[model samples]
Target: MADEVRQHMLECEARTWLRNGYNTPERIQELTLMIANRRGQVSAERLIEEMRRQWRRRSEWLN
Candidate 1:
């Protein structure tokens, strides 16, 4: 159940990156490391919240 939700959140994050043109190689690497480090420990809700906060802060730099 948790894994399923995590997979769905990952898919959504991928789509958001695609739509926003925000998935640079560096960002991908960061996300890869982040996921690898957090996998099976963090809840999907907490992960998504942190990702959203990061994105919000990052959008300023992106703009």
Candidate 2:
């Protein structure tokens, strides 16, 4: 369940980036590569941290 939530959040964030023109296909490919390369070195904690960071940024902008 948690993993599903995380994935949905990831997709949401990616869509937000793409819709706002902050993401290009090449950039997405690079980010995909980064994730692919972090198979063993990265943790779920770090991924959640990034999601929190994005939420913080959005919240700040809404202020």
Cα lDDT tens digits, model 1, 1-63, are: 999996677656755654555456676556556665777434434544555665656654444
lDDT of 2 by residue, 1-63 (tens): 999998777656644654454444565555556655775335433543454456556654433
> lDDT: which candidate is best?
1
Inter-residue clash pairs, candidate 2 = none
Q: Which run of 10 residues does model 1 get worst, by summed lDDT?
A: 40-49
Clashes of each: 0, 0
After TM-score superposition, what is the CA distance of residue 10 in candidate 2 from its true location, in Å? 0.0
What is candidate 2's CA lDDT for residue 49? 46
User: lDDT scores for all predictions?
Assistant: 0.57, 0.54
